[model samples]
Target: MKLTDLDYARQLDREDPLRDFRQRFHIPTNAAGEPVLYLCGNSLGLQPRGVTDALQAELEKWARLGVDGHFAEPNPWYSYHEIFNEPMASVVGARPEEVVVMNSLTTNLHLLMVSFYRPTPQRYKILIEGGAFPSDLYAVQSQARVHGFEPDDAIVELFPRQGEKTLRQEDIEAAIAREGDALALVLFGGVNYYTGQLFDMGAITEAGHRVGALVGFDLAHAAGNVPLKLHQWGPDFAAWCSYKYLNSGPGGVAGVFVHERHLGRADIPRFEGWWGTDPSTRFEMGPRFQPQAGAGAWQLSNAPVLPMAALKASLELFCEAGMQALHQKSARLTGYLHELVTSIGAGAFEVITPAEPEARGCQLSILASGDGELLHQRLMEADVICDYRRPNVIRVAPTPLYNTFEEVWRFWKILEESVS
Candidate 1:
């Protein structure tokens, strides 16, 4: 169906299995009190309706039980994190033992690097994408400095060829092969935050392993938005935040994945804490540290029950909707947005996100030739919410879970009016 046809959009919405899911979120309205056509799920997702009750239940538990809340039935604070195992594992395509919901995104990256990015004199360099999220860049640079190597000398950054916006898997593979034994780790975003380009993670993981390097991904934009097979892809470690595509509220708890092979390895170095100690003998106050099995061993402190309760609520929705179903709807939603926007702004804007559906998730990055922020403000004033970058790019995300086809059509009309 043609993207410009309102009936086509309405028809798709009517037929959509997940259409009712949008009503479950509290979408923000504009200054005039109209519901803003929000397309910023890539930054922060809308809050779910069940979040208030979930948080209140934990508050009541804390008030009534005091410290004894740790042992409460149904959702004991002591074992609350365990409930996420099955659902989270299913989302990332990993074994239950391999996944654990824990600290924030960058914090988990730093923690995982403690164990995985072990650099020897011969294998001391780290390879990464050129324009990674600033947090990952800072984390890796500081890691190199902490290990007594100069950041410039120990880091290898791969950039796109002269005139391209996205990366080629071949270029990444070539860099991994060329680095050989000097490479200690390969870290890239599963989806680039700014460009919204998804990488070939399986191929990158293979290339890193071929050169005896550990591989990991920052899946802030990719996880929950796209289907992942972290265990099958065989990356050594990975981390992501739940605030974006996961609909878990602002600064929601993040998660981690450790390959089962690394679960019980004593030789791997890590920054340990009391919570990560073996649960069987945890309260015994044993002198020696006995790390728990699986990714739970990486925990440094007790779980944050309030935020985790909020996460649990959103995850219940994802588990019900299923990632495969979400992804299929996401492709259709994003493709329609792409077609309509391109047709309307043909000579003025170019799509920088990859055209291939497999190489992207729900976002589309449009590179405009004029005042980016002014255009963004125009959209904002019109209640068509989106975000733009420093130079000349605006990013729009039509999230499958909460966004509608009619919203995408409205955004196209607003862009036409704003640029005209």
Candidate 2:
């Protein structure tokens, strides 16, 4: 019997060590009162059941103490962001001092660029993937314009070859070498949002340094979904949003990773605010700014306590389950989805994500052969929730945290019926 049968899916779910984790999240229900087959964690993860308690505790604190809650026990509002240092560091594979949970993804990206994208006449170009998320593209373009250089001339975008959807690692290394000393910085999405392809961050960082350029990554789609060793990879900096596979609520607090080598260096320029000041002299109202050591120095404002509360709930879950177990099950779960899609036995669509395990994460971007928009609408109507890009792709994410093997099988049925 084929493994795509319903019995096989049930067996897989029964044997899955992380099976109970699905109960921890509040899965959405359809009109008929059954839980929907939700595979949209790539866009926004399902809310954890603990989120309500987390937020409520903070709301009570604010009501009771008003302005004094910043010093309260269990979780002080003043040092709210500090609580995340160890857990966030573990999630991204960094030292506790190297990571900081702060502003949203794009905002953090712009802030990091201000300090790291130091363009000189000799090395003024920024290197990026051609099909990166639109927000990153806009940020990089504006950075060049702000530095008094034309966007077209100062930005180098590496694209795939003819009839190719995903970029090869060799091509990326070649581009970094071709740009050579002219490249000032290399900034890439650790996983391509459209194709769901995972770039070799280690190789990319090495190539950038070989050419005397700084390297960084926008891990919006990579973190929590894939195993990362940011400090070991030795990228100059990195940033990510928590809303997706991290299972944080919508618009949750984001985080950053700064290499230890840049610590205590006043040479790199950055935008400063009171929150980043040394805590010892922070309230002194001193004239000169003495920034905190490590990634804490990049913080620009007071912690947004409410959002951090929700993010904290999810990070707690991550620390407990551990990335090792999550990553191991993720590969198997995603592979099963890939198998089922290929056996659909009709040329209705194609999976554009790389086939190799190391070359992609949890998502599989399906390029519909025709009527892709209509197909997406029909899937939604059937209570199968995934996401669709503008033209052709339908991105389905089988998250290891809350998604199940049986759910993936159910989705395959829904997709097959809808397309047929």
Cα lDDT, all candidates = 0.92, 0.93
Can you write out model 2's per-residue Cα lDDT over 291-316, one digit (the tens) per residue? 99979999989999999999999988
If scored against the real structure, what TM-score would every candidate get? Answer: 0.98, 0.99
lDDT of 1 by residue, 53-155 (tens): 9999999999999999999886999989999999999888899999999999999999999999999999999999998888989999999999999999999
Candidate 2 overall lDDT versus native: 0.93
Weakest 10 consecutive residues of candidate 1 by summed lDDT? 341-350
Name model 1 segments beyond 4 Å from true.
Answer: none
